[model samples]
Target: MSHLLDNLTVHPDCRHFRGDLPCRPNKTHGYVCESCPVYAPVTSRVLIIKLGAIGDVIRTTPLLRRLRQERPGCFITWLTHTPAILPQAEVDEILKFDFASALQLQARQFDVVINLDKEKEACALLNTISAKEKFGYALRPHDGVAWPQNQLAEHKFLTGLFDQVSQANTMPYVQEIFELCGFDFRGEEYVFDTHEDKGFNWNQLPSSGPRIGLNTGCGDRWTTRLWSDEKWISLITQLQQAGYSPVLLGGEAEDARNRVLHATTGAAYLGTFPLPQFINLMHQMDAIVTQVTMAMHISIALRKPTILMNNIFNSHEFDLYGRGQIVGPNRECVCFYRGTCQLGTSCMEDLPAEKVLQAVAATLPAATILR
Candidate 1:
C-alpha cells in the first residue's frame, strides 16, 4: 500500500489502549521506557519548529494534527517567526520570536521536539530545546547552502532518514508526515481565520460573474517561474471578454508588474495584503490563476478551482495537492529545476494567453458564467 493509504487505515482506536501501554516511537522493536531513564512516562509536550516562507509553513500543518492525535493530552507549542502565515486551528500556542528574544526564553523540558529548519542557527536553537526525545533531519552535503542558509531543508532530508531507519524507501507527502507521527488525516482541512469583524470588502472587487485571482509575482526574481507581463495582460483581456473579472493579486514586489498589466488591460489590481486578509479575499473568489507559489497551495486547501502555470519539475509537487489544472509547455523545458531560466526563452512565456483563458473557463463554475 502507498504510504498515504497505509496512514488512512490505521485510525486511532480507544479500545486499542490497554491500561497505559508503553510508548513505542515507531514500528521498530525497541520500547522507549526499556532503553533509557529519559523515556519514562512524562508530560508529553511537543515543540514543533518550522519557520520559513508561507508555502513551507502551510505544508507543515498536517504534522501538528498527527502529533495531537497520538499524544492526546500533550501540549503542542509551535515556534514561528512573526508574520508567519499559518492556520490558527492547528497550534495550541504560537510563540512568536525574533533572533535576540528566542535565545533568552526559559527552556522548559519537552517530551519530544521536532526541528524543521535547515540553518546553522536553527541547529543551535534545536540544541537549546530541553527535550528528552528530539527528531530532526540528518545533515546532508547538498543541504543548508541556500542564500539565507536555511537549516529547514534538513527536515526534508530527515524524512528520508526516518524511511531508512524504518527499512522503507517510500516516505509520505507532507500530509502523511503528520499521519505517521500519529494524527488523523481524514477530515482535516487547511483553514485560516481572520479575527476581523468586517472581513474583506467585496465591494472593492468588480461586481461581475466569476472573479478570478491572478498572482503574477513570486518571492524572488527568478524569471523561469514568471509568465511574461504581456502574456498576463493578454490573458486578463481574454478573460474579461469571456465575462470573467480577473483581479490581480500579488505582493509589494509586483506593484510595477501589476501597474504594467493594469495599464495594458484595465484589470482590477488588488495589491498585497496580510496573509489572513488575502485568504479571506480568496474565499470570495471563484477560482485562482497563479504560478507555483503559496497562493496555489491556499487555493487547493480552499478547494477553489485553480489553473497553475508551473515549470515541469515543480508541477509534480503541486499535483500532490490535487484538484488543479496545470498549464505548461508540452516538452520537458530545459529550465525545469534551475533557480533562474538560463535558456533565452522562459517556458512560462511560451504558454499562450488563450490556453490559460480556456483553462480558467473550463474550471470556473457554470453558474458563475454570464450568458
Candidate 2:
C-alpha cells in the first residue's frame, strides 16, 4: 500500500514533523518510536477514542471489526460520545464521555489508547489516560506527533500509522487500524443492536407494496443538506403513485419539518423517536431514502436497501457501510470533506426529485421492492 503522502502533495506546514513525529515520512520529521518507551507486548486491551459526528462513528465500524479479529482474546473498548450509534459487536466496552467533561475521562486506562478525535482536548485527554501506548493525531507540532489538518487527511494519517505498525497492506486505511492491533479485518459490516423493537408494525403499515423510509434532517445545518418541503412532497407523491409507501423518520427536532412534509403529501411520518428505537424502526423498511446522515449508516447496517441524497461536501468513505444506493447533484462537488459547502449553491439542491426517485428505483432490486 502506498503511503498517504505518496498519493498527495504535503502541505508546507506538514514538513516540520515528518520522520521525527508519528506522521508519515516526508520532508518533515522522522518516526518517534526510537526514543518513546516501548510497552511490553502483553495481551492487547485496546481503547479506541472517536468523539465525532454520528456518520463518522458509523464509518469506524470496519476498524472495530479488524481489531477484534486480529486479537480474538484482546479486550477492545470504544470511547465515543454517541455510544448508541456503535454496533453491538464492535467493542467489549463502551465508554461514553461528554466533551464538556473531557478531563474526567482520563480516569480509565488500557493497554493501548488510540485517539481518533481531532479536537485539541481529545489530545489532552489522551495524555491523561494511563495507557502504555498512546496513538493519535498531533494537534500541535510535537517532537513525535502526526499532523492532519483536515478530515480526509486525518483518516489517511491514522490508517498509515496502523499500516506502519501492522505491515498490513490489503485492508483499507480504517480497517488497517484494526489489523495493526491484531484483529480480524474482514466481513461483519456496521450493525446496531437496539433493545426496543420499535420496528414498523407490518400490519399497521400498508401490507400491499414496497416501503421506502425517507429520512431528512442532517442534525446541524438543517437547510443546507435537506431538500425543500415541496420537493419531498413531490417525491412522496411520485413514490406512492409507483406503489411505494414513504415512511418519514427523523429526530424530535425535525418534528415540525416532518409535519409540514407529511401534511403536504399525506405520507406516514414517524417523527422523532429515540436513537435505539429509531434504529429498530429502520429494520422494518424495504429500503431507505435519506440525506447524508446517521440514518443512511443505520439503514445500511440493518442490510436494508438505501439511497443517500448527498450534498457537495459529502464523503465517499461512507460507501463502506453498505451496498446501498446514492444520489447527488450532477455538478462537480469540490468540497469532499468540508463541514459545510462554501459555494453559494449547495450541490444537493441541484438534484431533481425525479433524478433522486430514478436513482432509488435503479439501486433497489426487484426482490427488494417486492419485499
RMSD in order of candidates: 12.8, 15.3
**Model 1 global lDDT (CA atoms, 0 to 1):** 0.64
**How well does each candidate superpose onto the true structure, as a TM-score?**
0.73, 0.71
For candidate 2, give the lDDT of residue 330. Answer: 74
Q: Best candidate, TM-score-wise?
A: 1
Please, what are the lDDT tens digits per residue for candidate 1 over residues 177-208? 44333344464455445434545676778876
lDDT of each: 0.64, 0.65
Q: lDDT of candidate 2?
A: 0.65
